[model samples]
Target chain A: MVIPVRTRGTTEFQGKYPEEQFQFYFRQHWIRLFMPFARMILITAIIATMGYFLVELSFASGTGSRHIVIIMILLIFAIVQLEFLIHFYNHCLYMVVVTDRRIHRIKKTLFITDDQQSIDLWVIQDIVKSQHGIIQNTLRFGSLRVEAQESLLRLHFIPQVGKKYEELMHLREKARHWYIQHQSAHPSGSAPHPTT
Target chain B: MDLVYVILVALLIIAIEWVLWHLFVSKSKGLIFPLETDESSFRVATPIRLRLFAIAHTAFLLTLICSALLFRW
Candidate 1:
């Protein structure tokens, strides 16, 4: 069964044809990464309050340096905040775009920006979905492997990927058909092959 | 001694954050103009290292608060 492509809003492609383009979907890792920070905030608050009592107990027993303990707690709070910001930024680097022509994969790192790789739908031989580990199975998120001519690239940690796999396959089929038609019409001209 | 401890803690947090960013976040996968093509497609995921650091930082913050309460002049 094919999932009908719906036009949710009229922002980016109002006049350009709504059904033609859709919003890019990120892998579940993009969303799950925030879970740790959210959990940390709740956990840290509870621990900090408990630490106050623990400090009092230590002082009464005359066993611990109250000053050192207090400083350590403050440092912990700062570290948690920094971690959230870093994780947010790191998750931002992964991107996948499905255009009318092809699928584009982009990954960004610190010092240098990598070139984009586009895989024409016509060249895609197969779509493979592999899920390993308990969390992946339970969460229903895992990697979608795409096999193409020159190489194979995996789309990782896609949440509820069972549906996404079907969706991608449908899209790939559509792209392949489109390319074939375009090639027939302009037989002399060669399609722009994506650079690796 | 207190000042030195603060600096050391800050440096440690920064160092961890830097490593995670470089290793996972910033690893180049060959897409020069991804944002230009589709800004929303490229997004930052939750950083695991950063979360760990946050837990550590919370420990430090509690220490500071306690110090202020007990040893303030």
Candidate 2:
């Protein structure tokens, strides 16, 4: 007998990116997400393991006092798991997408949902890649700082993103050329638009 | 029983550390520093706090083992 499993709501980011317009979508490095909480998890795990032994020894000594240690260990493990889950969820929810038309920033949390911000290519004043230290230089990954007339957004700790700066600049140049052409053709439609 | 428990605890702690090192700190693209690069090289590298925490973790484990041994004897 074969058992059938139903899988619904399995769609992956439906129609999020138009395939024809945007050729590539680069995600922020995964390392950035994990680094924030790695030490916390490791320390908690170590403490929990030590607490286990301490509790065992206490019980063995006829003290009949294992409650406090056991509770503390459980609390530590629970907190670690909670932190890991929160970090994973936050990482998965926050995303940035670049297209020929505009750049999209999507930020979401469990309860709070933020609307996407679309920044046109022509308005992007500068794209800066800051790589400091021998590690960042040697690793070839650094932070990308995006500057626009209205706002400044810094994409932090993007690993293996050295090559992306050039690619983005190329894309932006192309977009700027297209915008200039569009403006020359349609004077009325080319009015400076404010991004909300 | 105590000796067996102590050994098991030690093994468990080692296993946990190994897993954490492999999953979080190991030189994957997921880690801040790629495994190939030295951690000290990056400016936005793993913080000094993490190194200190690692030291404290090691010390805690050693203390646990020593205490277990002293208690057992």
Candidate 3:
């Protein structure tokens, strides 16, 4: 039996193998990052102006927890950037790892949620791409549903859903051909067990 | 003391970073490409992003610790 053990970056990321190859990789829309980033900018600007005034006032009065206020500002600054960092970490981690052998939807999250689902590329039954709503249509990022016999995995907020759908179909065809070739190369019960 | 509280909070943030790294970065880091993950579809988000972030974050933590200790509040 060929068991799969976690081999650092290779196994988890559809790598660490001889035959597997990656086709495409993408994350959710850039808007997700942009939204938070814009917010951080706006908030930082407000905080900076407010901090300057508060500091001036505290200095004039000579009696205020000005140090604490500065501390609070630093804390707020860190928190804002921290949110972006967390988003970046999560965004990069949770991804669609499509290999020649299988389509791996690895949902790795930091906040106590880790979901990893994989289906053989040859077994993919249907791939549906949808772009609804004004934002989705105008921005051109939407969702993809890869349906199989046992389960249906939906990748939401993926940019270029149409392109991904087409790629999925192509990969499916390639996977089918690869499987056929592999099966033909090794006939049933013709070779040794688990040696290859 | 307030300084103690601030220190504790800063430490908490560090802990969170550590946890986040182990939980997500270890499993899904796509920064190095072949160095990090050799798979075809799996690529790190950006090569130097994690490095830059770590440097900036460490600087922030160090500053925060220094403030907490020096400010006495």
Docking quality level of the chain pair in candidate 2: incorrect
Q: Give TM per candidate.
A: 0.57, 0.59, 0.68
**Ranked by DockQ, top first:** 3, 1, 2
For each candidate, what's the DockQ? 0.13, 0.03, 0.26
> Which predicted model would earn the best lDDT?
3
lDDT of 2: 0.56
Per-residue alpha-carbon lDDT of candidate 2 for residues A1-74, written as tens digits (9 for 90 to 100): 11112121221232343332442333455666657578676877798679767976797666445655654665
Per-residue lDDT of model 1, residues A138-170, tens digit only: 877788888988967778877667877776787
Worst 10 residues of 2 chain A by lDDT: A1-10
What TM-score does chain B alone reach in each candidate, compared with the true chain B? 0.42, 0.48, 0.47
lDDT of each: 0.57, 0.56, 0.65
Candidate 3 residue lDDT tens string, B1-73: 4666767766777787777666655666542232344232223444465666766776776675556445633
Tens-place lDDT digits, model 1, residues B1-73: 3666556655665576556645643352232222223323222212444446445654564465445544540
